[model samples]
Structures are given as C-alpha cells and as structure tokens.
Target: MLSISSTRQRQPFTVLILICLLLLLPTSLPFLLPPPTTRPSLPTLRSPPRRSPPLPPSSSSSSSSTSLSSSPLDPLLSLSTLASVILIHELGHYLAARTLNIKVSEFSIGFGPKLFSFTRSIINNKMNGEEENIEYSLRVLPIGGYVKFPENYNSSLVMEEELKGREKFKEKLNVEKNEKGILGMFEWLNEEEEGVVKKKVKSGSKPKITTPPKEIEYYTDPNLLQNRRPRDRFIVLSAGVVFNFLLAFILYFGSVLFGPGLLKTEINRGVLVTSEPIPYSPSSGILHKGDVISSFNGVNLLKLPSDVNVIEKEISEIIKTIKSTETGNEIEIGRGSERITIKPSLAVGRSYPTIGVSLSPNFSGVSKIKTRNVFEAVKLSVQEVCKVTKSTTKGLASFFESILPKFGGGGGGGGGSISGPIGVIKLGSDVIGQKDWSALINFAAAISINLGVVNALPLPSLDGGQLGFVVLEKVRREKIEQRTMDDVNAIALFGILILSVGTVFSDTMRLFGK
Candidate 1:
C-alpha cells in the first residue's frame, strides 16, 4: 500500500519538460512553414475587376466593436470568473463527500502559497460525535482547487502533526511569564515560591512530575472514500462535472429569463468580413474589414432560405460559386454608403479551396425576447447546455484528431478552436472591454459547459478517469494497487499540463495572428 503523501510527490522535472516540448512542437510549426508567397500555388486564376457603384454606402456597423483590445481590469474580472467556476467545482465534491458522511480534512481554493486559512470543526452526528477539523484555505494561484479527505493521508504522520498543532495552540493560550520586567519577575518568583510551599518541605528541592506520552489515534472510519462502496465513490468523483453543468444551466436560465433575454439576430443582408485575409490570397487587400458581402455571382444573399444553418449554407454556396467559375466570381460588398463589386477567384491551398478570409453572419436586425414561462426557460437552458456540450466535445475531439496526425509527418494541424485558461481569460476580457456584459454571461455559461465536457473525458487523472477506475474495481472485485494508480495518474497529469501549455502557446500565436 502506498500512502497518498508519497504518491503525490513531485514528478521528475526532466520528464515533464520532455512531455511539454513534444506537445508544443506542433505550435512551433508555423515558423518553419514557408511564407504564403513562397508556398507552391495549386490553382490560380487571372486578376479580377473591382468596381465601386455610385450608391449610398451601407451603415451596417452594430453596437459591438470588432476590436479585441483589453482594459486593465478585464484580466482581473476574467480571472475572478474562472476562480468562481473552479471554486464551484470543488464545492461540488466537498458537498457530495459530506452528504455521504465522508470526512473531508481540507477544502482549498487555488495552489501555491497560502493567502488566508482557517480550521472549522464540524460535528458529524453519524460518526459517534466525532469532530472533524477541516482546514479551509485560499492560496495565491487561482489556477485550480481541491478537496482532501483524511483517508488520503498517512495516518501516523497526520496524528503527529495534529498533536504538535494542538500543543502549539495550548502554548499560545497560556500567558507568558516574566515579560513585564520587574512586575513579571515578581509574579514568576511568587508563583515558584507558591509551588514549592504547596509541595511542602521542599526547600531547594524540585518536585518533578512525569506523565507517559499520549497514544496517537488513527481514523478508521468506514465512511472514508476508499472504504465506501463503489457507488458512493462514483458519485463523489462525478459530482464536479455534474456541478459544472448545473452551474451552466443556472446561468443560462437566469440570463434568458431575468436578464436582457436572448439575443436574436436575423441575417437578411450578407456575411460580414471578420478579419483580414492571408497575404496574396484572392480576398487579400480586396475585401476590407467591416465589408458586408451582399451577393455572390449575381445571386442575392437575402434571397437564401433562412434557418439555423443559413450561415453555413451561404458559405457553402459561396464556395460552390467560386469553384464553379474559371472566369472568377462576382462579389458584391457593402462598405458604408458605397456598393462595391469585386471579381476574385479562389486558390487551392494545402487542404481545400480557400479565399484566406473569415466571415460571420451579418445581422440585419437584433432583438431580445423575454419570456415569463418557467418551462420555456428550462427548455431553453437545457437545449443550450446540450448544444454547447456537444459542440465542445466535437471540437476537443477534432483538435486531437488534427494534432495526432502531425506527429506522423502529416503537414497540417490545429483544426478546431481550442482555448486554455489563458485564452479564455483573454477572450472574457475582450468581451467585457466591448461592454457586452450579456455576451459575457453567455460566454461564462459556455466556459462552464466546456469545463464539464473536458473533465468528463476518460483520459486519466480526470473525473471521468476516476469513475472508470471505480467501475474497473467493481468488475475485478478488488481494489487496484495505490502505487499503480498513482503512477498512471502522474503520467496523465503531466500530459494534461503539456496540453495546457500547448493551448496557451496556440492562444498566444492566435493573439498575434500567426
């Protein structure tokens, strides 16, 4: 049997460094790849015409600014939101453990040096009046948090420390002697004399009393996590993700019902140009930012069938029109009051035909709908959670799917939009800086859902991984060796850290538009 203390010892720094390097190798690939101009061209077409019609420009600028600039307090607010999510996650586990009559030794937010700490004595009526002293602490780092149980500790070491702490507490309570100079000296002398006189006939003789050392007690409560039934352990392990989902649901429900309602946008105009295109691409230098693409190949975008997939349909139609023509496709864009027409053809890239531009749905109008119907709100929240979870799961899967091939000499990588803690904070800050607090609420809910989905992945060291172990134990009808499980967990944790670092690197790259 391996004690949890020994199992949690820091892993080799070299091994972690190696893993991080391996994981981050893909992120450094952009630097090695040839620049856009130097890359081999797959398909090319003649330069197209550009015309600005004598018409009033489109005033399609919405309230939201496209700038991603950050304010001073934006990062702080984002960090606070992240901390709140983590705290809620830990609280889920803590509450579940307590509900199952499990003794929690500590509940801590964050890691590293402690900022504030306190001990709470909780009386468990089911444990024969046993008082559980749980130490709760807030640390400096806001990265993560945890809940600890006595079952995870070395019994002997814990007992020794408890005894030492108790002794120190008693020493603090007793008044110091001889600290007041002459007055204190007089009090000490009087106390010594009184002690000697009370002993009787003990002049110049000290009466020594010795008591045997107290025996240390170990906690053998059956309610300890490892001692509990497999089902109970499963609940405790899965509770974190469950709480994350619940938090997302609550936020969505509150926002949709009580807040400014849900934002409903109709894309009756055209797709908005989100960012600049890569250099030398078809749309490069031609389609400027804030341009509304009103039509493609003489087809009006407003005439397209409207639905949830309308944006995707429009994009698909645009691509189809580009590929269908060798004489270049006509593109009508609305920029302020001017109606501009540009003929640009698509270029074949390493993967697919691309114009090297990003586009999003251009809203014709925006409205908010508030409903007092509880059932409607509940339905909407549930739908939102499920949709987010499904998309997050797919995105996570695709990211790995894309990156795994890079390890096998595959040229391209990084398919889906992935963000780590740092990326999320930056995004949250940007939303706040834009003064769109409603979007921030929705962003928080989305983040919560993402957290839940990621933690529920059974790739080791996560909640889902732990739940898998419990199931395995139940099937085997025996417990796995703690050392073996610890080793697996350590490896998995290192992998997670490497992945996090890689994501941060990716986020940084994206921030710089690399």
Candidate 2:
C-alpha cells in the first residue's frame, strides 16, 4: 500500500516532466533537424490611420507626440521593473540574516495569495539529526514583499543548557577515570605511561585500562535572530533600505553613463520661431519660422543672469518690457549665420505689443549626455539621487500636512492629494508615452529613491520602525514584550489598510474622471 501511494505521487512528477519536454520539443526542432525549404511569402496588408492628422508644431504638441510615441508594453515593463527593485530590497534582508547565521523561514516576492512556492533544505546533518529549510514564494500582487525569520528566537536558555551539558560530560569522563585502578590514572596521563605500566605488570594481571577521548557533541540552534546581538538585528532590519539606495545609485549611474539621450536647454540661444508670421501684424514677413531672437529691443536676451532662477526672472522681465512698449520694438534675431533686425508692430486692438510669429518659451532639444569615464558618471549620479531624494521627501511632507488636518479638529475644505497604485500606473504610462529613454530611466531611478526613503521613515510596520525598536532595546537593555510588539504591528497594519483603500478610491475617481 505504501509503495502504491509513493508511485501515485511519482506519476504526477512523471507527467510534469513529459509536459515540459513536449513544450521544449518544438523550440529545439530547428537545431535538431536540417533547415526546411523556404516557404512563399504572404501578401502584406496595411492598416488605415485611426486618428486625425496632428496639429502643426507651432501649437502644443504634447498630446499628439504622446500618442505617436506610446508603446503597448510600457505599463507592463514599468511594473516589472518596479517589482525587480522591490525584490532586490527583500534580498538584502535575507542575505544579511543568512550572513549572521540566522535561519530565515521564507523569502517571498509580492503579497497576498501565493501563486507558486518551493522549499529547499539549506542545511542538513544526518548524524546530528538537524535540518533547516527555506521556502521561497511568488504571489499574485507585485506591490511589496518580505523575508520572514523564525518567530521565537529567544534561545538564551537553550545556550545555557548546552553549556551545562558539556560540563556534565567532562565530569562523567573524570568520574569514569576514578572508577578504574591506578593503572587507569596512569593511562589517562599519557599513552607512553600506560604502555610502561602495562609492561611492568605481571603476566595475567588485570587488563590494562583504556579511556577513549570523550566525544564532545556540538549543536547549533537555527533560530538565532532574536538571540543575536542588538547590532546584528539592527543591521538585518536596515539592510533593505541600504539595498534600495544602492539600486537607485546603480540605475542613475548607468543611465548617465549609457543613456539614450538627455533634454537640454541652452540659455541666450533665443526662443524658437514655431510658425509663419500672421498677416496684418508687425514683422509679419521679417521674422519667420526658425528665427532665434538673440536680442529684443536694446536688451540682449543672450546675456542674462547665470543662475537658473535669475535667468527665468530676466526672461520674464524681457516679456514685460515688450508688453509695456506701445510702439514697435527692434528685435535682433539669429537666422542661421545671419543676424537680422526687425521691429514688431503694435497690435490694432488694445493690450501689449504684437509679434506675428509664434514663439516657444525655450528651444529645448534632446542630446546624448554620456560621461567620459565611470568616475564622473558616479559623481553626477550621486548628485542626481540626492536631488531626487530631497524633492520626494519634501513632497511627502507636504502631502501629509495637507491630509493630516482632515483627520484632526481643524476641518479643511481642500484635502491633500496623493497618488495610489492606480494613479502611479497612469503616471508611469504617461511618462512612457514620452518615448524618451533617458526620461524613462530617470523616472525609474526617482521612484527607487522614493521607495528607499519611504521604507526608512520611522513608521510602524516598516523597516525603519523595526530599527526604531532595535534602538529602544539597545537603550533599555531589555527585550520588548512580544505581545506588545505584535499589537502595535497589528494597529499599523490596520492603518495601512485604511490608507490604501482611501488612496485606491481616490485613484479610481481620478481614472474615471468622476
């Protein structure tokens, strides 16, 4: 009956193997057999345009450009990339625990219902009758993941018992030696003394006593995380944050080193003339498309403040100057290599001065921006990561500030806005629609840095919260009550659930334009 049951289990394994083989067979057929004769090509069919023609470049092209650049896999690719980073973050904790000889029970990616799972024995000792297994799993959702260690690792008493047992073994060896005669004592001293004493003894004397070396057995408790030094525990808890920051740095550095392109805006290059001049307006034919305004009136647009903010201020000043002047202003524009001067005529209707041609705020262009060496890339990448971190920190602070009042006594009419999973997906889709590789990479890096920062916030049910507990334990020199910790975590979990649901609701409303 046992054999039959075992065979029944093996049948499923056999079937699985056969299915896998069959699936692989077609893929391997090309290599296994000679190339087949070429088949006749089918007639190609072309699909008609699904949308209207794009507007002229002079008008805002954001919508049309996005439509043209978008790819079907953008959302899926972004989600997968995010999942990969989250997995790395979990791996950091898993590795740290394993390095300290703490047994991790499970390492799982994603949350909720498990889609697939497998277990492997990391350590097995038949003689000692000891085995340690780790289960790895994948789940249906890709929001977050975790690495679980043994729940009860407080093994100080077990260590004490082991020490006492070793001492008892030594005492037993000593007692056994005493039970023997003087010959046994001599044998215990050295092998040479035992042999000499045996030769000295008369024939047929009591057999020389022999005492074998005591076998000192050793055992290791796999559940060591709780019993480990506070420093180790702290490191294990903080490893996830460290790995997340590392991932951000790597992504930023790689993007700068080998990015597809970068968006750049050169100052004093003059605004781009986007359209042909309108008739019955000043400088209708004089200033045409592609003209770069080097100087407006007497002010040189090329020579403005060096600081970015100050430069923007100066540009605003130029616009104000033009609007204030009722008469036409002499504008020196750079057209190719030639510098042409034209005066924009005053508009017939009341308001500001008029220039017939449409002008872009800035002539921004995309250019490759790779570093010459890795060191330079690393330096720049670090700066970029720092900048993004600061911005995200500020944004989160603002978000909390806006939302906190709603739950408090002071009622605010406008509640704070936050992007949930759905919102994030929409935002990611828009970014991917830009079809700029540098933009995509930069966005990913920013998200990674934000994830790191969020995990490091001192809130319950987070890595930082775990670190906070470790710090308290270190300061108090006492283990916090397990029940209290569990209760606190449960409350945190509940709070998170409420927040997630609210965010999801908000995201749904925003998605459906409600």
Candidate 3:
C-alpha cells in the first residue's frame, strides 16, 4: 500500500514531521526578534491648596520693569499704568505744541483737584486777555494728563467768528443782499456799551453833553493761534498723537532690545520650569513643583518627530488629544531620566486636561540686553510704534465683540470692570516676582498703544476730537462758527466729566465687590 500511494496522499511519518516543524517555529521566533523593552511608570497628577508655596517677591532690573505671569488678570489691563502709559501720552501733546511754536499754558497729569503743582513761569500776557495764566497742577486722579495750548480757552475758531459777523454787517447795505446772516448780531456787542450812553441835551433844562467815552482796550494779537492757517493748526493739533505713538515705539523698542522681547521660538527650547502646578487645583501634589517635563504622552514636546514637519501641526494634534481624552485614560510622560505614567483625573469644569501646573519656557541671555546705540535704538523705536498701534486695535476689538467678556459695562458680561492703579501695580509686582520680563515689555507696549488710540479718537476733549474740527473746516473751505463748535465741545466736555465720575463710581463699586 505504501509503494502505490500517490504524491498527494502523504504518509503518516511525513504528516507527523510537518506538524512538529509548525509547532517548533512558534518557540524559535523569539530568538530572531527580541521583545520590546519595558517603559517606567510616571507620576500621577494631584495637588492640594495647602501644599502650595507662598508667592515669591518680584525683582525689578533697573527702572525698566517687566515681570513673569504674576496674575492672569494683569495682562488684561493696559490702561492702569498711568505713569508710563498716560503721562507719556501727555508728553506727546506738550511736544506737539512745542513743535508748532504754539504756546502751551498748562499741562495737567490728572483730572480731579490738585494734588501738587507749580507754574513753569509767571504770566506772559501773550494776547493781554482777561484770562490770566493758569498755574496747572497734578491732580489726585492718576488716570490721564492734558496740555493747554494758547487760544484753547477761546479756540482760535471762535475769534474768527466774531470778526466774520462784524465784517458781514459792514457789507450788508452797500455790497451784498441778505448776507448779514442773523439780524441781531449787533445787539450782542452793543448791549454791554448801552450802560455808558451819552446824555442828550433837553431843549430847556439840560445842556447837550456828549462826552467822548473812554477807550476800552480789547486784547488782540493777529500773529497768534488765531492767525495760523488751518493746516498749520491741524498739524499742531495732530502732533500729540504722532508723538504719543512715537514714544510708544521707543518704549517698545527699549523693552525688546534691552528687556525681554517676544519669544519667536518654541517654549520648550527656552529656559523654564515646566513642573509648577496651576493654582487652585486638585492635581497639584501628584505633579511635583520642580520636575521638568521632557515629553508628554510618550511623545517628546521638545522635538516633534520628523513625520510632524511643522510644530503647529503637532501642537494642534496634542490639543485635539487633550480635548478628547477621558479621565481614566493613562498619560505617558517623560520626566528627568524617568518615564512616568499618570492617570489623568477629570477637572470639574474644563474641556482641557488639568495637570494643575503651568510650565515656564527657558530663556537664555535675558539679562544681557542693552539700549545704548543711538541710531539702532531710534529705528527699533519706530517699528515698535507701528507694532503697538496695530496690536491695540486688534486686542480691543475682541472685548467689544463680547467674545470672552471680561471688562465691566457691556451688552455682554465681559466688561469685567476697569482695573485702576492698584490693579496695575499688583500686576507689575506679580510679574516681576515671576521673572517674566517678556510679558512686562509687551504690557508696556500695549498700554502705550492704548494711550495713543484713546487720544486719537475724534472726541471734543481729545486731541483727535479737535483734529476732527480742523478737518471739518478744511472740507468747508472756510472757518466754522466758533460759538457753535464751542457749544458742541462744551456738551462733549460735560459728557466726559460724567464719564470720569462713572469710572470712579465703577472702581469704587468693584472694590466693595458690588
């Protein structure tokens, strides 16, 4: 039977051998390829409030102050740095006045009653007008400052109005028709003189006495602000904004060249302690305050793999994973010389992972910047001005949109409230303590930008507001009625006074947590 069996029909011995070889291959495969090495367990995420350390004091290098993230709220306020922010804005006005040879009577640093002040000089009587020279002083309010230019009291446009009205009267009967404007303009001037009427002689009892009236001098100077061309006046009026933007740039450049500049590179490349836990969290303990995070979830945050060509793409992926991850899922992280697996706990109210710690980026050579070069400093200064103006517009737009409502007063809840000087000081101190100079520099730039923007708004009391009037005159190709514009300005001024009062009230209300 074995000799006659076909090739397809296997013998029992051959079938048994084939079965033995198949079984042996499974045991020998391990010798060809070894098993993967074991990975170490990571620290769990956890921390308690009592275990948190007290906040460290800030360190200011020179008078130029920049701080690390002292508080989340600090970066949100650009208006609170009154000295560096608001004072510099006023400097713009003063310089602009000087540039156009316009006389500035007073410069007030604050809005309310005087805190302390002194006049730069005694009265000069430029126009010899009834208005005496004002001795401007600093006010208790530290929010803003102003420059008083000559003719600001009357606003040059006002003088032209009186002259035009009188001239129209002179031409009414002889040269033109219906050109006298209002019929009763003469009544306004003559009402005061009516008191000194000459006595008329009665036919029998009184002799005619027409004594010449004593000459009353009205202060007039044609060469001053009244005589300046609208274009020139506009230049002077617009100069303050120009100077404010300029100063903003200079400060910004100084901050960049001398202080910490914006970090253009990835944070992992910089000097930082990634292990500090985020505040008021439960995971603070499982994560130590000193350990540096080398990688997150088995992927190194330092160098994203070659397949991840762009850093932003990797970051997007990481964020997506963080958002999708569930609480019971284990997080694989690399610490200094150790691999740790942590089971992420769900944070009560957030969509993101709550490791309860914030990491600082490493920055080298922060203490080595210098702002001594004249030309380079000036160039950087200019760039900064442009940068700040652009940034201010962008940031404020978000708040106005109610996208994240933070500041107080709004159709939305975002107008959290205005943070005054106390808030800014607290922010400054907090940042300095954290040693985050880059943040501080950016903050200063932001404030300067805000100053420039607010000053440039076309409001009656602001520099831009006055500029708007000048533009109006240019379009009309003639001077507008000063009284009309002045009246409009007066209303505007009142509105501003009310706004100031509101701001004070708002600040007070916020202090008491109302």
Candidate 4:
C-alpha cells in the first residue's frame, strides 16, 4: 500500500463525510421540521343542491280542475306550487270584491276575451257583506284576471281612510251623499216604474236582469263620477289594485313559508387565515382534497350559522382575510383526520390552491325544518322575492335597452337572446357560482314577478290590455266602438306575436353567446 502524509489522509476522510450528509439531507429535514399544523377533517359539510325540499300537495279538484295535474310530467318546478300561484291570484280579486259589499258580475283566469262565463245572484244569504251574485267566468285568454264592478269606482275617497292611496277591499254605503254617485242609484230608482221597482215576488233573481224592461233605464245613475265625494269613489276604484297587490304578496309569502327547502349553492373549502403569505384559494398550494380546512386557515371548518346573513358575512370576512395574508400561507388541515400544517405555496396570483379534485356539497348538514315561523318566514321571503323581481326587471329592461343594443341590440338582425334547456341549466350553474341561498330565493321570486307583470301589462292583445280598454272607457270617458275595439285587439295580437318571436330569437342567439 502507498503511504501518504497524515494531513492528506484526514482531508480525504472529511470530503467523503460531506458527500454522504448531502445525500441524506432532504429525507432528514422533513422529519426534523414540524408538519404543517392541522385539525380534524370535517366530513359533515354539505352543499344546497344535495337537499331536495318536499313537494306541495297536489290539487284536489276532480277532472281538469287541478291545472298542474293535467300534465303527468314533473317539471323543474313542482307543478303543485306553480298552479297554486294562479289559483290564489284569481281568488284575491274574488275575495276583495266580496269585502266591499260590491257584487261581481264574473271572475275569470287568464286573459284575452271571455271564452266561458256563468252568473248567479244570491237569494237569502248574508255573509261578510257579500249579498249578491257570485259569478264565475273563464275568458278566452288564459293568462289574466277580470272583475265587473256594480258601478264605476273612483279611489280618491275613503271617508274613513284612504287605502293608502291605493285601491283595496273595503265597504262603502252610498251614505247620505246624494252626491251624484249615490244620487244616480236614486235616479236609477226614478227611472223604474214604482210597481216594477218594488217587484219582489221572486227571490234570488239576478239584480242586473230584473223586473220589466219598460221600467228600467240604462245610465240612469250616471253622473260621470265627478259629483261623488273623492273618498267614496276612491275606495271603490282602489279595490282592484289592492286585491292584485295582496295576491302578489300572498304568493311571495307562500313561496317562503311553504317553499321547497333546497338552495342552489356550492361546497367551497378554502384556507381562512389572516397572516399567511398570499391568499388561500381552492387551487392554491396549500388547499388540497385531503387537507382539512378551517376558519382559522389550517384549523377548523366553520360551523354554519343559524341566521343566513351572519353565515354569509362571516364566510366573506374569512375569505378576505385569508386572501390578504402574505403569499405561501401556511394552513392547518386534517388529512385523513390527522391534523397537519399545510403550507399552501403560491403559484401566480394566489388563486389556485389544490389537492386535485372538484368538490360538491354532500347533503350532510343538520336537516332543518324549513320555515318554523310562518309569518316571519313569509315576510322575509316576500321581501326577498320582490327585491329580486324588481332588480331583475330593471336588469331585463337594461339588457334590452342598453346591453343588447351594445351587443347586437341595435335592431336590424339583432343577435337576439335565447336560453334553451342547455342555457337554462347553465344559468343554474352560474347562479351557484355567483351567490348563496338568498340570491337563489330572490331569483325565484323575480321570475314569478316577471310572469305576473308580463301577464298584467296592458299591451294590445294581452288580457291586461283588454282590461285596460275597459278601464279607459270608465276613466277616459270615451266610448270605444265595437269596431275600434276589434281593431285594437287585432293590433295587440300582432304585438304579442312580434314579442314572442323576438323573445325566442333572443333566447336562441344568447345561447350561442352572440
């Protein structure tokens, strides 16, 4: 063996030791450093789509009485609830007229001209000021409401109280106001032969088709509503609007009180820490499917709040805090129930933190009894729906007036908007991404309002429009000839056609993202 200096031998030994240590450093350091702090995996989290609310009781009318039942298929909406909305709306008009001691000539659902009508007068029954004919009619158009008043209504007066300057259900006796409105009834009495006027042989004969023809006179009491006390006439006229408003409110409340107990929401698990580097997102370095996430970032999943508002607000804050923290946020998560700290290292902009999987809500939250307090729930729900409806209406109008125009809304061959089944499904997906339950509720409510408004608009051919003409005659004091009425009806029909085509076209184009 070649002999070397003692110094050279020691140096070679030192170099060999350094290379061995370098080889084992990675494996050794992991054991030396404490694992990213973590907590228990909360497997109980759930998303809204997982829960399905109970369906309403089916309508109980025999034959075709139950509208929704007519169809055997279950649609996106429960047929029962949707049908109930229509029934209740018409009922509002009927009940309101009954309250005021006013007689209804007929009541019908849907719009357009009348297709079927039946009339009847009460004989010897008195219940809550309802003393006369309970007429029920169905019009040709099946999308609206109609009520024939005994006399013209003027809502400016309600001697006791104005219906908040609105027309609502209430009673009024012509009272001592020989004021043209009441006097006209007296004048009506004058026009009839005394004997014919006193003709009371039969019971329950229709008040409208009474006695001998010679004794009666048309417009006998007409004083043009001008001579009546403002309050008196006002109350009578306000009844229609009041009834409609109430019906809408009831529908609003009913949706919440008895609505299905499912929301379209997402199962979002992300780091929620205040002092980490960069924001923690589902696709960030630290967030992973196996890593347990908590409100404290790496600690615990949040316990959902009893109050929806608080839950939303709290979650929002947690997210903001986590995002604002420094990049490479160290989060504590429980993987396989083993608590460990996960350093969600940053990538680009702190957006993608991942363990590699798309998550959905597992229906695992405590099953809540939907709407324990009916009244409170109803009130909240109605407000939510109304707000949604109003906002959506504004958005729709803006979309047509502004957005559409900008994106092909400028008339000629406008890339019209449309949403077919595919588009509608996409809408639901977008909704889940955008907001929580409240937003979903509002979306539902807004759709209902839109349906109501469209049905109620007094456009040509629409039921409301026909009713508008009926109202205009009384308000405008100008009689429309049958020919003129026919012409208006024709034009309105055309308008409806145009609107339908445009709507469908727009929906189709929109689906194409035009």
Choose the strongest candidate by TM-score. 1
Clash count for candidate 2 is 1
Tell me the tens digit of each residue's lDDT in model 1 across 107-220. Answer: 777665789999999788898888889898887665556777654446457456767877754454244323543223223335765455445433545333222333434345
Query: By lDDT, is 1 or 4 better?
Result: 1
Model 1: CA > 4 A from native: 1-6, 9-71, 142-144, 152-220, 265-272, 276-279, 284-354, 361-366, 411-414
List candidate 2 segments past 4 Å from native. 1-69, 112-115, 124-130, 140-144, 153-223, 261-368, 411-417
Residue-wise lDDT of candidate 2 within 266-377, one digit each (tens)? 3234444656788866667677665566565555655554333344344555555555555645655555446776665666674556566655433332333567588998
Per-model TM-score on C-alpha atoms: 0.65, 0.54, 0.46, 0.37
In candidate 4, which residue ranges exceed 4 Å CA deviation?
Answer: 1-72, 75-84, 98-103, 109-118, 123-379, 402-447, 455-493, 504-514
For model 2, what is the alpha-carbon lDDT of residue 143?
A: 47
TM-score of 3: 0.46
lDDT of 4 by residue, 318-391 (tens): 44454454556664444335555544333554353432223322222222124658778766655654554454
Q: What lDDT does candidate 2 reach at residue 165? A: 71
lDDT of 4: 0.38
Which is the winner by TM-score between candidate 3 and candidate 4? 3
Which 10-residue span in candidate 1 carries the lowest summed lDDT? 29-38
